[model samples]
Target chain A: MARTEIKIGGFGGQGVILSGYIIGRAAAIYDSKHATMIQAFGPEARGSACSAQIVVSAEPIAYPYITTPQIMIVMSQEAYTKFSPELAEGGILITEEELVKTHNLRKDLKHFSIPATRFAEELGRKMVLNIVMMGFMTSVTGIVGVEAMRQAVKVSVPKGTEHLNLNAFNKGFEYGEKLKSGAA
Target chain B: MKADPKGVVAGAYFIDGDHACAEGAIAAGCRFVAGYPITPSTEIVERIAERFPLIGGMFIQMEDEIASSIAIQGAVWGGKKAMTVTSGPGFSLMMEHIGLAAMTETPCVFVDVQRGGPSTGLPTLPGQGDMMQARWGSHGDYGIIALCPNSPQESFDLTIKAFNLAEQYRVPVLVMLDECVGHMTERVVVPPADEIEITPRRYWDGPKEGFLLFKAGPDRVPPMVKAGDGYNIHVTSLTHDERGYPVMTAAAQEKLVRRLIDKIRLNSDAIVECREEQTAGADVVIVSYGITSRIAIPAIEQARREGVKVGHLRLITAWPFPAKRIRELSHHVSCFVVPEINYGQMVREVERCVAGRTRVERVSHGGGAVHNPKDIYAKIMSCGKEERK
Candidate 1:
């Protein structure tokens, strides 16, 4: 892509920033592209609608803020309601199935939903939900390669839990592949 | 000297400017850091707190910005490279100590990840409003070095340069990072230990029996001796002589203060740095620093595409104001456009240097966000048209 703008939004504890970081790192470090990630800062980010914006480009990203995000991964109802309307025409919308309600979405957008938290719970750690979502994002959008995201996730997660996170990512990736093949 | 291997994290990784700055401090051999965490700048201290222990360094979370500012000075006197990080409000709280550091001629770094503010404004947004305050906030005729990095990679590289400048000049150096540059994340490649060069403190190896503590040699910088190093030293904020005693006379003030100002003023040729592009034959130039410089690139390109003959001058070191270069360009260029997040801080400097030789246009923003490139391009186009007329 010439330039791809991605916005990830959720509450504070959902690792919204980390998911953006993983995606940005995958593109910038592993895939040899330029990526700039900026997170929502200050007091309001604690328990409210926090977000992270990532810009992936073939060249250096001069403008940091996203005007019209080409992709939005919302993990909360508030985030969905607030940010979904701002998605560009013919953009991609990825959301957590159990958390966000799809309503009044743009018809031109390519929408994908996954129960990332439930998948993480099935993998025995609810904290890895962001990683699962990241895996799904990688597979669904193909913004970054699968192996590159896996490498980024390995180095990014907390020590001693890389195995669990990788498993969660694999589960989400498998689900995304199944959905893409129209078997879900 | 090459960086110490223990402090160097040699690899390619994606990290924010704040974390990259923390790594630069470690790589620059910063052994002690004292800070009170604040928004937009907390990540710097947090990263330092996490990595300092492993590098055999110390990180102290002080009660507040006041204590945090002075605590780093004490660490410097105790024979350690020290620093403190903060945002606008904390930076305001630190002005007094900054004066003290200037007076005492301490070698330390102060990382001000600036946010929008006169008083506690916009903690989450970016601002370049502190440019003037960094130079004159401390109410004195003393000199300090301040650098503004435009990207995360420069944030890592210039941070080390900040420490080196502090050591070389024996004065506190400021790393003036706005919120945008501080929080913006990107790929940073930290070189191996052998690739980095460090400037060690110029310690006095002469006899302590007849030492003049505040005396300067040919370099206009006094050699330092650590406390508890068996040397009698007196460090105070008052005007003193070479012996470090309060002279309290006009002569004493001139002798002490003149050297303090001259140290950086005379050596500004070595201290000041900037990046210039297409200035060899251009009609208009855009002068900018910090995040504004990055945003100005596309505007410059756009103006060039419209055949405006535009050049770019990016300020890597904002202090000692690259006046000589600007003055030289003033003679040839028809106009100089300055775009900053502030309403007009550095624009005044450009006007002063131009001295009515050329039109100086200010593309000012009031700090919440960066400038729209189209706005800057419009200014450039107008300037170019004016020049053509």
Candidate 2:
């Protein structure tokens, strides 16, 4: 069976992990696929670069960690610096446009950018930036269905705040759709 | 019997292996847990600590590993199912108590979420280096039961199995989990409480007048009893008679130790469980446990893609080492490829069981990250080119 390896990277407390978690829940719980998520753990504090590796497969997962990711979604400059080069040729690269700047970009891959941090601020919850990224990634990459991603975000966010997170997700998803249609 | 419906959270979860183990322990009716928080394994006790209070269970964060290890034994003797969670350094400290549990026939589980280690090597990385330690580090010739779980689901299932085995054999069962499996998040489907079968504690119900604490029943497993229920129980770590008194004689040692080992050895056919895939007619059979078994899949498939017949034997039970199956496979396969996180721990067991009947190829590393599948693929390819049996 085919396995798609994805990496989500950012500093601590950015919900980078929850972003990966939502995708896994979407794939494994909602989409009926096998999803495994492994996050980097070390003596890490806030603002330190960290990453989560996710593998979604049609069959049982083998060799769990992401050796070379086919999808790289980075939200921090440090994460972009450390993980972008590891993306395989012809992979999809999604970035939080307001937080990460592109340089020494690979030519063989399709790159999409979204102002996730700005979208979250517009939604009045800066912490939901990861959800915004998740929405944008779902629309741009189509790795998971939009409905499954929405269900995952709804169930994963804190109680009584699902509406706001969904708004943040909708903002990023709309922007991604615009980018796909060359309207933005 | 079915599990207590109060503790079973019947639903699907996206959780790590450690958390799944905690849930499994609860679903299996574990009521007391004493542990010292260690990385990779701490989440187990943390989850247990949170859930225990609601279910009338108790969780103690003991001062150190030594205290944590022995505390569970105390809880077991108090008529409750108990367990202790630890990693490498803590596992080392719990060795003496493991011997204590074996000598006293304490039914409890010890969970070692192994990390890269000799000391405090890689606190958060994965390793299967402690496989041998789980079997032999406790000292003495008493038989032990250890289980290796590959993923979050197995971590849940095997923890319940570990507790049941511990109760049946009245021995300390080790749930050996590597950091990768313990920390990796995956989908775990928990069935309803009524669907989960549990092995209730084998309690002594015979006349309490002339109770001999250590006397073996027909199954070679002595039934357990509560201490304050008018039954005088003397449990110890020394070589003791059926009366639970230390008898420093060699004959006493022979009887006590022999029964301890025989209880597990004789019942090994029932205790040992292994999952074999595609070993019917293959050139190489990969013997692995814990995360290494899952990591070998791509290598197995890669070798197959290159026209190599590679079979895989994933050890669901590590201790009592599945010798009969390996001996049978030895005559049928050309070689056994063992890929483990340690330099070579379980490979020795495979060799001992194979007895030179087949080529035993080892793919090994120290501890830390998992083996590169390409490296394992290369080993399988090399072994695949050999003559078939």
Candidate 3:
């Protein structure tokens, strides 16, 4: 890609920064592309709106901040409300189905939703919801290759929890594949 | 000399500038760090605190920035490569000790991950407002070296350079990082220990008896002796003689202060670093540093697309300002455009260097965010128009 700007937004404790890091690492380290990730640095902690912005490009990324994000993955109502309007024209958006209420979304935009939190709970860890979202994002957007993201997730997650996170990822990936195929 | 293997983490990883800076310090054989945690810069010391113990290094969370700054100097005297990290407010508080470090000729590094400032301005946002402050914040007439990193990779690389320069010159080196670069994450490849060269401290190995503590060698840099190394070394901030006694005389002050300033000023060519792009036969050159350099790239490319013949001079080392290079370029280029995150700091230096040889434009912003590429592109276009006229 020439340059793709991605914004991952959610309340704190949702692995918002970790998800962005994984995506950036996948592209920059594994795929040999250049990626720059910037998090919203503020006093916002758990239960407040938080975000991470990543710019992946074939060339070195300049102007680190995102002017108009091409892709936005939102996991909270507050994040959806705050960031959805800033999505670029015809941009892609992915959100957690159970948490965010999608209303007044742009008609020309491509939208996808995953019950990532529910899938993570089924995998016996609610914290891996972001991993599920990552998998879903991989399936829907294809911004990063599957193997690159898998490797990124393996190295990024805490040791001893990789298997559960990978399982959650596969579940979300499968769901996203089904949705893309019009089988959901 | 090659870096110690214990201190090097050799690999490729996606990391933020703050974490990369800590790794760079470790890879450069920095064994001690002291700092009070502050925003944007807190991660730098946090990484140091976590990784230091593993590599047999030391980290201390001092009560404040003042203590943090002095503690690193103490560590240096105890035969350890040391550094302290902070943001705008903390950097302001540490200015006194920066002067102390300069006067005592202590080899150390002070990392200022700048944020919007003048006293706790925007704690979490980016700002290049501290460029001038890094050069002149401390009182007195002493000179210091300051390096500005535009990206996470440069943050890692230049930090090692900062430590190396500090050791070579026995002066505190400043790694000037804005909050944007500090918080931005990118792929940083740290080479193996054997590949990284470290500048060993200039320690005095001769007889300790009657040793002149403040005597300069042939290179004008005084050799050092650790506090516990059985050397009767007297290190004080006061104007001291060769034996390091507090001498209250005009001759002593002149001799001592002149060397302090001359060590860096005279050897500035060796310490200065910058990158030039397409400057030859160009009408305008954009002088920028830190995050602004990165942000100015698009405008430069756009201006080139519009056939404006624009060049780029990215300042990798912000001080001992690159006056000689700027002066030489001023003869060729019709104008110099400087876009910084501050109202007008480095632009003034560019203007001073140009000295009416050419027109200089200031693209200024009061901190919080970086300049829009469109705005810079507009400036480039206008400069091109002015040149045509």
Docking model 1 quality class: medium
Q: lDDT scores for all predictions?
A: 0.92, 0.91, 0.92
Off by over 4 Å in 3: none
Sorted by DockQ, highest first, which candidate order results?
A: 2, 3, 1
Residue A129 accuracy (lDDT) in model 2: 91
Write model 3 residue lDDT over B1-389, tens digit each, in one string.
99999988788889999999999999988999999999989999889989988989999898999999999999899999999999999999999999999999999999999999889999989888888888889888898999999888899899999999998998999999999899999999999999998999998999988888789986689998899889898899999999888999999999999998999989989888999999999899999999999999999999999999999999998988889999999999998999999999999999999999999999988889889888889999999998788
Between candidates 2 and 3, which one is better according to DockQ? 2
How would you class the docking of model 3?
Answer: high
Ten residues in sequence with the least summed lDDT for candidate 2 chain B = B380-389
In model 2, the Cα lDDT at residue B366 comes to 85
Which residue segments of model 2 deviate by more than 4 Å?
Answer: A44-46
DockQ of 3: 0.90
Compared with the true structure, what per-residue lDDT tens digits does model 1 show for residues B3-48? 9999998999798899999999999999999999998899999999
Clashing residue pairs for model 3: none
Backbone steric clashes in candidate 2, count: 0
Per-prediction DockQ scores? 0.78, 0.91, 0.90
lDDT of 1 at B296: 93
